[model samples]
Target: MAQESKPWYRSQTKVGVVLLAGSAILATVGGWLTGSISMANAVVALIAEVGALKLAFGIRDWPVINRNK
Candidate 1:
């Protein structure tokens, strides 16, 4: 029997994670290049961004609610 073909693109979570990581890395690099913000501030900002992303992706699908009850 023939094997089934795999998906061409990566999963949503994987893609999102990569994007988030890359964004943090880029921001850190930019901050370093500017030399305005300290390393500690950059680290804190990265942590906050990651935390927000986690909360966003952790959310579950909710059913629509009717207002006209």
Candidate 2:
């Protein structure tokens, strides 16, 4: 088996890392503005947080349903 050679600067992972940081900052600022974090806002932020995870670590392509072939 051979490994793929690529440049570090143009990596997709790098972009995802940047986006994750941005989302974290936004959530922090939002919580600060509201004086206290509430369940609703926390839920929304959680979703964004998970989405960022998917972006940073690419999701697997698993079939949603089983097909009877």
- Once superposed on the true structure, which residue ranges of model 2 sit more than 4 Å away at CA? 1-35, 61-69
Model 1 scores what on Cα lDDT? 0.62
Best by TM-score: 1
Alpha-carbon local distance difference test for all models: 0.62, 0.61
lDDT of 1 by residue, 25-51 (tens): 688769867997898888887788777
For all candidates, the clash counts are: 0, 0
Residues 4-45, model 2: lDDT tens digits: 444433778856676776778577667857868876776777
lDDT of 2 at 35: 65
Residue 13's lDDT within candidate 2 is 81
lDDT of 2: 0.61
